[model samples]
Target: MRRLSGVTIDCAEPAVLAGFWSALLDRPVSAEHARPDWATVGSRFDPAPRLTFQRVPEPKRGKVRLHLDVEVDDIDEARARIEELGGRWTGERHDYPGEGVVLGMTDPEGHEFCVVQYF
Candidate 1:
């Protein structure tokens, strides 16, 4: 069986961007990693894969190709929490007759990800 360990994000500041994701996902960065170029957050407890942030010299351009779909208990509450942690809402929402709602958002580094609530 193939197992996925985590997802790596590319950004200009690893520590700063990692902070936003660490708080949002409720995972602490690994103490073992002392390198300033990389940071990681996540644990086996998390239902999804772990998150890793790597330092890059350039800022992101245009839109990201991959978007993470995060399932939340409450869309509005989750959105609020994201902003409180430094992320912002994209001001876009999609409704599916009986499916549920999806809210678009971006991380501090402008990586696109979605908050999903299924009814």
Candidate 2:
């Protein structure tokens, strides 16, 4: 059986970004890890997946080949929260009409991702 383990993001400061995501998801940082170069946040109660932040030397450029889609109850509220967490709202794409709404955004390190709301 195939199972998803974790998603890792490359950033200059692993702990900082990890903390931001931890607050966004309301998950506690993993106690098993003791490395400054990497940080993870998640737990068995939620049981979704761990978000791992890794240290990288260079900054990201152009478009990201892979990104995440976060589901939210309110798109506007989610966008506001992302901004308050040091993320920037790039733009919104409404191609699917009534199917869903997607807002393109980048983290502090410029890694592009999308916030999607489906009804």
Candidate number achieving the greatest lDDT relative to the actual structure: 1
Tell me how far the alpha carbon of residue 80 in candidate 1 is from the true structure, in angstroms, after superposition.
0.9
Give per-residue CA lDDT, model 2, range 31-62, as digits (tens): 54568798888843445878888898987767
Q: Which ten residues in a row have the lowest lDDT in candidate 1?
A: 40-49
List TM-score per model, in order. Answer: 0.89, 0.88
lDDT of each: 0.85, 0.80
Model 1: residue 113 alpha-carbon error in angstroms: 0.4
lDDT of 1 by residue, 1-119 (tens): 55776788988888898788878877787743568898878754556677778888887899878888988999999999999888999989999879999999999888999999999
Q: Indicate the worst ten consecutive residues by lDDT in candidate 2.
A: 41-50
CA shift of 92, model 2, Å? 3.2
